[model samples]
Target chain A: MRKYLFIYKSEIMSELQYVFNILIGFIGYVIILFIFLNLWKYIYNDPNELINGYNMNQMIWYVIITEILWSSLGGRKLCRKICDDVRGGNIAYNINKPYSYIGYSLFSHLGSATIRGILYIILGMILGFIFLGSFPNLNILSILAVLLSGILATIISTLLIIFIGLLAFIIEDSNPFYWLYSKAMLVLGTIFPIEYFPKVMQTILKYSPIYVVSYGPAKLFVEFSWPNFITIIFWQLIYILIAYGLCAILYKKGVKNLNVNGG
Target chain B: MLMVVKNQLKISWLSIKYALIREMLNKTTFLTNIIFMVLNNASFIVQWIILYSLKDNVGGYTFKQVLLLWGIASGTYGVAHFFFKKAFSLSDTINTGKLDSYLVQPKNVLISAITTDIDTSALGDMIYAYITLFIYGVTLPNFLLFTFFCIIGGIFLTSISIILSSLSFWFSKSDIIADTGNGLMTNFATYPDGIFKGIVKILLFTLIPVGIVNYIPVRVMVSFNLGSFLIVIMATIFIVILAFLVFYKGLKKYSSSNLMMAKI
Candidate 1:
């Protein structure tokens, strides 16, 4: 485990050497931040009119939290990378190594995700301060819930990515799947809150793991309840266990073919 | 020039057929596209329901009026996707060094590149939009005139797509521009143009230019304004000509070596 920790750290250090690329990525995030801020600002032009349960400030806070949660734990690109590796024969090299392939991927993904999480949180903090001025009377328990949700969001995202990436072994050009999945994230990830959805869609979303990742956590941070908080944590554990089962099944099936293409 | 166009059309047809066949055979692409189309339309339908619940008209558009606008816009976007998906993926082609193959082709490079990856899945959106339009009880146009407008709409949209895509040659990456352009168009196109005021309205007419795709024709169709429709036709011709000139000019600085077209 210590050795793998070193590997993960070393891998991240090398990637950090591409400082320019990381900076470019940060610029991309900033652009999205600006777009969302403007969009919300337009919607909240008159905060006095109470639309739904919350005012403009609260609604925009939802936008901020959702955006941060998404940026931090959205592992779509990492999934694509995993798919690329599986299809491109890079996974074969890892399989021949001493550690488990899933373990290696998890570590590598963690290293990168830690960086993204930090970047997203710091950016969100700055934006929140600039716009909302410090905290909005958020409690310590709510803060803890937010942190727990963030961790679960990361796990759910990583597991979902790993599952989809494994599809590359069975298919040609996993991009079509990746593209559709990413779009699904737009709906599922609270780019528009699930409340905006129709009754049927709301029902479907309630049970979807996506809700736990984005909606559950964001809701907790904004409106705290001990029962709902415990419920979300329970769902997270359930999802994690299911994800582990899926990983084991998919890896075994994918390895049976063992026909990795490209170098 | 006439001969160049004729030959380009012929080659584009062949490439389109080949791509359609490839996509049809590829179950993954076909199924994924189908799911995406359904989900996209579903989201729009949900949004419309919410908006319709609040009021009969949003920004001066009746429910059916907005549906007509969406029908035209989404149908036009669908057709664009159906035939010119490769052009839409210009950044990918450029980044992956796949542009070399298109460059080597005997046909117009842009036409060939665009026709090569036809997205037939867009047909679903086209069908859905038109069906909705029909269900809304829009009066039937003279068949010949409707056909003429459809052709003009296709060309106008293609011109806009080409101009947007050609920016990739000048920039390191143009995906963000493409995405932003598409997002803005999709968001704004649902509402009537009359809602937008001042600089934004003017910007939509000029800079974004999505107004050319659905707004003008649908407006004319609804009001039966011959003058406006004719103006739209003329504008379509002007833009297509402009797109060609700009693309060819950009080709001059192409520098088609391995360095410019870096392999992914």
Candidate 2:
């Protein structure tokens, strides 16, 4: 735990050096948010009308919250690092280190993301207020729920990326897998609520990672309810177990293959 | 002048040829990238389909017109990346002094730098663009016009990247600015222009040029407007000349890295 904390602390310190890069990266999201704000305004045609059970403000805020999760999760960086480690045979060196590679990766990512996530949330809120005139009407309890769910979703997202990266042990590259996973999250989760999807896809996606990873936190933030909160937590637990179990099995087998190959 | 243009075109062809061969060496990864990119792009179209299902039009764009908008966007992006992928990363090349290779070579530096690589997945985008066009109903004349606009749009997009990246000549770490500019152009190109108004619309046309890259192309494709089509052509020529001027002007300030690197 102490070693992981050290790793986390180091990452946070290093990331602070690139504060401008981090902020500039958010420009794309801001542009997209502005487009969505105008788009929903035009679509809704009336501020009071609810097209898909969400008023204009609620709809735009939903996008803001989900997009924040999307950008702050650090899934792409995690996947690329793991992929590089495996492909470049650096994982063998990492295995010899005092700390577990998985723990170091997870903690370092979380530490760096902690700072960026806060900044992103602040930016999202600023954009929200600029376009919609106010923030989401959330009390302390709901904010707490959203934060907890966001952390879990981040974990699940990171685990999924690691699992994809582990495929580098067998394949030449695992970026294509990350590509598909990100597109799934982007189209199904971030851009629109599940309600906006086709009825069939919505039903199926409810049980998929989109629910726990992207939709759950944003949904709870916009319209909090006890049943939805409990359901999200339950799904997150199941996803956690699945991601962890698969990663453990894959890592074991992958390392064995590497050893047999004299890597 | 004719001899110089011919030599540059030959060099560009060779560069693209080598880049494609290098990528094809890893056949499985190459195929996987292209196939998955098509699927990924398809997912966005699905989102648009769902949205159109809810309403008749968005920003006065019918579903079919939206299809054309996406077709132009994807096709233009494909042409830029598939043939000149390194244009998108020109800032990194300049900042790291990788321009040394192109400078040492006896060719147009900007063209040589941009043509030295291909993004295999962008081929998928090109194919997907045509698929979208086919679904929108393809006639011979319309197909030719779309292809023409895609070339213009591709040049326009690459010019924007070059202009932004050329700023690396002045600033130490301007890659982020280039990236932001590129991102804004890409993001704005997919949406309907009618949604934006006033200052935002003006900025889109002047600074980002998403209007010339995408919106105008879609407009010309939807209805045969001779005036708008001519504007797209003229703007493409103007941007290409401007990109060349900026890149060469910046080249005067380039300090070679002297690092031994070769374009594989």
Candidate 3:
């Protein structure tokens, strides 16, 4: 455990070495936020008006929070790492390691997520202040609930991404799938709140793990109602269990076929 | 001149035929391409629905006009993919050093790279757009002209795709750049050209050149003026020529690998 913690620290230290890149990434995030804000302006068209159950202020606030959440997800970076490891024959090294593959993957993911999450949170809070004039309500219990749910959301997201990324092991070329899925998520994840989806779609998306990553957190950040909070936590736990089971089966199968070539 | 024109048509036809066959036979590649097309169209529908729910039109565009915009965007995207799908995958080729193989080919590397990897799934979107346009655009006054300019717009889109792919040689990462180009293209092309004024119009016309794809042509078709129509055609030719120059200039920077390295 201590060794893994050390590994996580070194990994973070290495990431911090590239301070400029992180700053530039934050700038890019702000630009995207600007574009999305403009889009909402067009969507609203009238001052202080509401569209689709959300007021202009609420809509802008929603966009800001979602952008922050979206940036933190970082599924693309995780997907790229998995594909690179598989393609570059580094999966064999991972297999030889002492810890379970999934454990190692999750830890490393947590480290990367930590850095991105901080940047996103700080930037999001500042942007939220500028946009909303203050933070949303955050009682002690609700704050605790959000922290717990956020962790669960991150786990579910990471595991789901790992499952998708593992397709690289099975398919000769999975680049197109990765690109298509990520882009689809980017557009679909933002356009409509999943709750606004038709009843049937909402039900289907509730089970599909992608919704948990984006919509669940977006809702929590906005409303933070008790029933909504408990529901997401319950679903997230269920997803994590399912993800663990799939990862175990696949990792065992993948390891058996793993062949290490030139480093 | 007649002979030259005839030869060009024959060559282009033959290339299209072969490309179509290659795409149809490759099941995985074909399916992958179709999935992206479906996702893109689905997202557009969602946006359209949202807009309709809000009002009859967005920024003076009627329901039919919105459909027309979708038809135009999807049709041009499909046409571009049919001719230059390989442009979308240029990042992988460059990153993996597979571009060396294209550079070493004796033929025009830009044409060779793009045509060799045809994406026929774009055919699905093309069919969808054609049906939608036929159904919706048939009611418009300038129906025939709209169809004619759609073809020209498609050609311009193909030119843009090729040019964007060629940019991979100059930039280490073209995926983001290509994505940015597509975003800008969709946002600009879907709107009626009249909404943009002054410097923005000039920027789209000269710098971005997205105006050549759907905007300028659609605007001309609506106006029903011979001079505006002629200008649209001239703009398309200019953009295509400029794209050709960009590709050739970038080709000088493209490096290729030999047979031994291609052994995967």
Candidate 4:
């Protein structure tokens, strides 16, 4: 645990050099948000009107939060990195390393994401305030819970993505798999709240990882309730464990298949 | 001058052909790349399908019109990436002095610099574009018009990337601008133009130019009109010319900063 924390801290220190790299991503996020803001305005003739229990502001804010998370977590960086390491045979050097590769990936990614996420969070906040005023009604406790859930959401997403990255052991490239996963999240929850989806589809998505990975915190931010908070947090916790366990199993099997050539 | 233009076009075509032949060496990778791209695009359209299910229209676009807009967007993207993948990477070329090789080449520098590789996945985008067009309802005339728009949109999109990416000649680390420019063009082109208002709408028509790339083309597809068609043609020519102008002008400031890496 201490070694992981040290790795995480050192990675953050090293990641500060790439602040400009992350901040530039803000422009892409702003454009997406701006486009959505306009689309929502056109959708709801009245700003006060509600669709599936969300007003224009709620819808817009939902997009902001989800976009921030989506942009911050990135779609497939870790998976691609893992695939590269595995395919390029660089993972063999770490075969006897003191630290576990999965732990290193998770920490290093979080380390970098910590910087990028905070900036995007700030950007998302400012953009939300600028485009739609203050966030939809939320108390301090709910806000804290939402933040906690957001962190958990990132963890689960990271672990799952790392698991996909580990697929470099068996399959060729994990990118094709990641495309499907990311697109599901994008259309299902990141771009639009599940409420806009049909009733039957909504129920399935609610139970799916998209709910815990994306919709949960954003939904809580827009509309806060204790019951929803408990359910989202509980599911987020479960998914994190499930995702991490999957990554560990995959990494173990992948390492066994690891063949290194050229000393 | 006409002969020179034809020769340059021939050279560009040859460069692209050779690039395709090289990619053909890896048949499975190339085919998978194209297929995955199509699947990626199909996944995104599902968002609109869900949205359209709830609303009859979005941003002055009917479901069918949305399909047209998306089709043209994908077509333009396919054209740009498949043919001129380096246009998006022009800033890197200029910054790292990769442009030096093209400068020394006898052929047109911009054409040579851009046509060195193809993004095989963009071929999938091309396939997806036609799929959407066919689904939207295809006539012989409609098919011809769609092909024209895709060809023009491809050139226009490439020119947009080149013009933005050429900024590296005057500024250090301007790759972000180029990347954001590319992202803006690709992302905004997919959305309906009617939703954008005020300065953003104007900007989309002018600077970012998704309006010219997909919006106007989609309109022409919906209802054929000579004036609009001519505008598309003229706007495309203008953008292509403007791209050449910007790149050449920036070239004056370009200095070779190659770091001893041999391309050979």
User: Cα RMSD (Å) per model?
Assistant: 4.6, 1.7, 5.2, 1.8
Off by over 4 Å in 4: B1-7, B261-264
lDDT of each: 0.69, 0.87, 0.68, 0.87
Each model's total of backbone clashes: 0, 0, 3, 0
lDDT of 4 by residue, B1-264 (tens): 898889989988988898898888867667777888888889877788877876899988998889888899999899889999999898888888888888877789999899888888899999999999999999999999999999999999899889888888888877888888888888898888888888988998887788888888888888878898998899999999999999999999988875566653
CA error at residue A243 for candidate 1, angstroms: 2.1
For candidate 3, give the docking quality class from DockQ.
acceptable
TM-score of each: 0.79, 0.96, 0.74, 0.95
**Clash count, predicted structure 1:** 0
Model 2's DockQ score: 0.78
lDDT per residue (tens digit) for residues A31-111 in model 1: 455545554454454765665566656656676777776666546777778888877778788777888777677777767
Candidate that scores best on TM-score: 2
Q: Please, what's the RMSD in Å of model 1?
A: 4.6
lDDT of 2: 0.87
Q: DockQ numbers for every candidate? A: 0.20, 0.78, 0.24, 0.69
lDDT of 1 by residue, B107-194 (tens): 7887777777676668766766666577556455733444455557666767776777677678866755665565565556655665
Candidate 3: residue pairs that collide: B100-B256, B100-B257, B101-B257
Comparison by DockQ, 2 against 3, better one: 2
Ranking by DockQ: 2, 4, 3, 1
Q: Which ten residues in a row have the lowest lDDT in candidate 2 chain B?
A: B255-264
Rank ordering of all candidates by TM-score, starting from the highest: 2, 4, 1, 3
Tens digits of per-residue lDDT, candidate 3, B1-264, equal: 787667655555577788777666757757766765565565556656655676665655666676776677677777777766776666556556676666655555556556555666677667667666775656555666666666777677767666776677788767556656655776566555444556766977877776666665555544567787787788789878987898788767766543356321
**Model 3 chain B worst lDDT window (10 residues):** B255-264
Model 4 Cα shift for residue B168 (angstroms): 1.3
